[model samples]
Target: MAEIMLLLVFCLLIAAAVIFKEDRRVRDELRTQLTQRDAELADARDDARRQTAEAVRLKRLVVESGRSPAERRQLDEEWQRLVASDEVVSRMREAGLSPERLVTSAADVATVQPLLERGVTGEEIAQAVTASQALADAVSAQGSVSTLSPAELVRLAGLGQAAERSGKGEHDWPPIINLSEAAGYSFAVGSADLTPEFAERLRSKIAEEVVKIMGRYDAGVVEVIGHTDEQAMGKRESNLDRDLIPVLSGKTDIGTLSPADNAGLGMARAVSVARLFRTDPRFSNVTVIPLSGGQMVLPGDAVSDGSSARDARERRRIEIRVRRPEQPTQP
Candidate 1:
């Protein structure tokens, strides 16, 4: 009986040892899970705070005038400043969007967040923004956007479709026009120089577009954006996504400037276009903001689909958009 008792005690000790080992492993796993959860919670709090602040700013902006010319100009600048924030731009880049191509406002940034969260592409977000703005603009003359009737909404969509198709006096209605389609002259491969024929092309196609946009939208500023394909420039290897700050304070001559990659080349091209418009009497006093899209946008303002390889011709293009002010003049 004593021997039996000793064996039982020994068994108990082994069982205890097994339980202790299992407990230690389980405790370690729980600790790891706790750490992960804590980090997640912290991230959630940060995002919530940022979103709250953004909501407040948007409310204030909305309360401000969007119809008076001076008030509208101030609002445009405010919108530009908000969209130009690093966090917003970073979000755009993560979604394979070129921030340069986006005609952003405070509302656009807010609308983009939920779309990004749902894994929607930036190109889709841009389309949504465009459609939303069209409806909003139509309602401005009648009343608040919230009071838009169903028929008005349908009309806005119809107009959007019409704009997408053949627009009246549409020079570059799609915004993204292939150079081959828009320009008459050819540059000896990889050159941004606008020859006499190219100049005429601008005068006919792009200039006309600017005039129509100015007349129709009463826009204060016209942004000229340039894009190129994934093709390599010259014989050197280079990155295409680098930025070129617009030469706002001085002259931008296409003949004198030599850029390295597709992005730089695109900037030079856009600057060339801007310089052309600057001297034109039609665009006199009108602001032309040039931006480089490089090879970021595929045909039809779609974001690149992660393929470094494509029909190079389709991506070589230029796009334009107008910024409307509250009480905009001809410019």
Candidate 2:
């Protein structure tokens, strides 16, 4: 009876150990499955969040596209007004600047930021705008404008390339200088004679400015164009065809030569100026060409309406222009 009881206890112990091992294996499998399911659910949630964000962005784009251009512009202006600091808005108003009139381009914001921080005044802003408008007019007349922003110009100042252009019909041209005769640069009524004082001014002031401009643009040519009014030289004898060479060669004085018409007078004056430039060491490597604009172009480069007028001082001027040399095309 004692042996049978002991064997029964041993059998019970073995069965209990086997049952505990099987339960642990089943628990580990269940835990692993639960962990995998949790991982899958997290991934699904992330995907759903991304999709929701994308849908919201697309809906916003669709709404924006549905608005008219003017409405969109108004909204943009309103947004700009709202985002501007209260102090800035007040200062701008005090300075007579309309918030609606402020058109800030993406590139312009960087330029305007510092000005805003430093409290730019109305007068200064107006002056800047006026100067910008003048430049824009000049560029538009040339059929293209510079693509460089203020920041880019500052950076390129070191490279001697403050402005540049690309694409068809676009050009990076130097500014034209229309030197008025009334501004202390006047010549004699009918002669190409340049006074000592006027010559000195040309050499010192005008030449220096032209040299600076040339340094900036690296141009190779200088053109001196002479313009005259509708004043007719009444049947005066012209020795220009015979004496032009001698006058330019310094063999004969310009005073000895006579121009019969306005065209001859304009040509004579241009040649005199070109000679001065050619003799200057600063313009030695640069080609200086003399051109006669004659009396065909009006004060603002307008064509003559065949209306003859005498002693129009405003129409008498010397125009100086600079240009780069043309490159030869490859075969």
Candidate 3:
């Protein structure tokens, strides 16, 4: 009975040992599997991080490269072709989804279409037609391509066209002919009276060319400005030289006359000349405006230098200045 009890206790001890060994083997297997899973998880995280970094770098590269309008158009056409191709469609199906996300966004697509039709390029179009709003916004912010509005573009184009036309020698009107000498008419003498010799010379040369001058300039009006030297009538007094009124009165105080009074005398002289032109039918189209320079612009002296009669000839002079109709009207 004692031997049987000892054998039974040994059998119990063996069973317990076997049970403990099985538990240890199971724990070791579980620990190995957990270690393998942790390694796989770490590898997956590294690969995901690498792929995310690569994507971010590609996005940055796309944003940095500025594309031209021509390039943009080409990109648009190429994208459209790819989207329409069977290869893209098949790949999209294999991926278990439609290819909407891969396709260009509507706004970007719209921006590129017109540029493509206008002969823009692929890389340029790709820059504009990205899914990334930040990229698109960055490109748009550059203000190089899309800065000008449609109206501004049209206006600039028109100006360029006009400049080209001008360079090509297109003109709306004939070239103006500037007369070599002064126009209108003038006569110088000892008095305001018109000399017959002066009238005859004018009737021949000026009156004959009057029609030609009018037609050439398309002049609506003609102006005649007269100028004279500083000379006035001498004052009269009782008793000194009674019969010498002619010489003394001629030597009047020219400096004392006011501008208005001098201008009046000049106007009268111009009126006399105008009357001569008006009498003839050739000057019918000419409208005469009379003005005065008073003593401001003196006539050139016909006498030789150092002559005592310099003042005498200076007082006996007249002037004429011809101008176009478009000349600004002086106040």
Candidate 4:
């Protein structure tokens, strides 16, 4: 009876241990499943939010893309009203054409369409109209209205006129100085060297005149721009080799030296000129700025008279631009 009782107690102890281990394993598995379920729920919510935002963006795009027909019609009407204004008509007149003719004639459509397509806004068109009216008034006052031409139109607009000129068509601004006149200022042969006489004239006469002009205008800054001919750099085997070449080549850097050389020459010339003006006490307040204009602004080339050498001289000259200081406003 004692042995049977001890065996029964041992069996009960082993059974309790097995039941506790099974309960612990089941509890761990349930916790892992709950964690996975929570993660899945969060991921679904995130996906739904992203999908909703994208849908909103697409809907906005669709709404914006499909404008109402009525709105488009309204825009067209506004554009037509703007183009049909008296201001536009006046601009056409200033451009050397009758406004009524421009509107009625089919030939005028070609001209109007191009100006419109060139990114000229309605406001610009209106300003052009005003300018045209002003020019017409000026011409009428001068009693030269009959002499008006497209070249005159460009002059009134403060723009460079086209090359061609026809009687009764247009009048261009007269050349400030012809190439022959400009060339007569100095005789500079090749290689950036100026004759002593030329240098003296530039320093004494031109520089002195510029100083007097600046003093007369009470200008604070005088910009001295240097221009040059379109000549190639380096020695050539023939005169034909004097044509311009690209600044860069894989092997030699002779052309690269051209810019520096040109710039130095320009600076030296400007300094030589400035020295004359600086001698005067009246010009002490003015500042001089030297700049190289490269081969730009071929002023004489506007008239193609087969005088390239003469035109080249006009290109190779100096310009003086004056500016004044901004005055402070008094309260």
What's the CA RMSD for each of the models?
33.6, 23.9, 18.4, 28.6
**On a 0 to 100 scale, what is the lDDT of residue 176 in model 3?**
22
Deviation from native of the Cα of residue 165 in model 4, angstroms: 32
What are the TM-scores, per candidate, against the unseen true structure?
Answer: 0.41, 0.49, 0.31, 0.32
- Backbone-clash count (model 1): 1
Tens-place lDDT per residue, model 1, 1-331, is: 9999999999999999999999999999999999999999999999999999999989877776446778878877987888779778898799998877665565767867897999999799789889888867767766555586888778976876775675533344324334642344344367667678777878887688778867764466777777887876676543323323333323333455667887888777777777778778898868888888888887676788657765465566666677654465696
Among all windows of 10 consecutive residues in model 1, the one with the lowest summed lDDT is: 238-247
Put down candidate 4 lDDT per residue, 93-192, tens digits, no spaces.
Answer: 7888886665588775776678889998868988998998987788778765447786775685552222242211133322121212256655354333
lDDT tens digits by residue: candidate 3, 129-238: 56456644654786773577657757866866874666522233323221111332334332334556656855676556555555544544555545555555343332
Q: What local distance difference test score does each model get?
A: 0.71, 0.81, 0.55, 0.57
Best by TM-score: 2
lDDT of 2 by residue, 1-331 (tens): 9999999999999999999999999999999999999999999999999999999989977988999999889888987888777779899899998766675454666677788779997588779999989976765675433666667645755444424332111255677878768776777878898878778878888898888878777788899988888877888889989987777666887777688888888888887777788778999899888788889988777899868786778788888898888799999
Q: In model 3, where is the ten-residue run with the lowest total lDDT?
A: 173-182
Best by lDDT: 2
Off by over 4 Å in 4: 1-182, 187-193, 235-268, 279-282, 300-311, 326-331
With candidate 3 superimposed using the best TM-score fit, by how many Å does residue 27's alpha carbon deviate from the native? 8.7
Better of 1 and 2 by TM-score: 2
